[model samples]
Target: MANEKITEEEVESISSFARISLDDDEIEDLVPQLNEILDYFDKIDEADTEGVEPLFGVHGKKNVFRDDDVGESMSQETALQNAEKTEDGYFKSPRVRD
Candidate 1:
């Protein structure tokens, strides 16, 4: 990245590692696009955010947990009524191999 000159050997090794097959034409086309993307990230690294607080939400956050409360749960009859399949008081679905 110092000179933005990634060698053909490096490119070949990366391609092999990723198990990707790219002909000479594709590598020629990707060289500048990859270089441009890297340059953009490099430029962004120069930003000044001295006192900025890191944000997880654009809107301010509220409590992420609920207060503990004792409650009665829905009956199984009501729960299985909405299911596509129910047998022996349990939801049944297709078996997934993986």
Candidate 2:
């Protein structure tokens, strides 16, 4: 890919999409930094990775599966003992939506 430079307008547009407000000085500073990051990615793109298998996990460990076992559980009173609000043996929470 060609060495494309990031423009101030593009930085403003990116900040707008990210819901962030950037001053003129911040935008000016970020242009070169973002461009440098893109240049590093371009260097990475030029690497030769032929015959390399894709790695799934960095730790090289497969997921261990165990059988689910039935366990004893606390009673409703015990569960609601520390609750601030309870109604009809259930925890009551503030209404979130109408």
Candidate 3:
């Protein structure tokens, strides 16, 4: 894996695909890091997990919640009492999209 070096052209191609611009210095720095990552993956591929079951998660957890029962509702005025802005008796929020 150490002999399998990453080329500048490959790095440039990857940067172009990712929409990131990389100078010569940055590309040189990334070559080693990327090669190291690939080497780590190669090591992982050689691991002995023949009988090991794949784990979806590390922790055994479950959701805990109260029963969803209908409750009393607040008045319109009460609901908008703390709003910074209102329009036509409703909470007015800023426009987010064109």
Candidate with top lDDT is: 2
What are the root-mean-square deviations of the candidates from the true structure over C-alphas? 6.5, 5.0, 5.8
Q: Cα deviation of 32 in candidate 2 (Å)?
A: 0.7
* lDDT for each residue of candidate 1 in 1-98, tens digit (9 for 90 to 100): 46766666667788988889989988877777777787888799899979989787877866677879989999999989999998899999999863
Candidate 2 TM-score versus the reference:
0.59
Pick by TM-score: which candidate is best?
2
Candidate 2 local lDDT, residue 70 = 82
TM-score of each: 0.52, 0.59, 0.56
lDDT of 1 at 41: 83
Candidate 2 worst ten-residue window by lDDT? 1-10
Q: What's the CA RMSD of model 3 in angstroms? A: 5.8
Residue 8 error for model 1, in Å? 2.7
Q: Tell me the tens digit of each residue's lDDT in model 3 across 7-69.
A: 889999989988899999999888888999988898999999999998766675556578999
Candidate 3 local accuracy as lDDT? 0.89
Q: Which residues of candidate 1, in runs, are more than 4 Å off? A: 59-98
Candidate lDDT (C-alpha), each: 0.82, 0.90, 0.89
Give, for candidate 1, the lowest lDDT window spanning 10 residues. 1-10
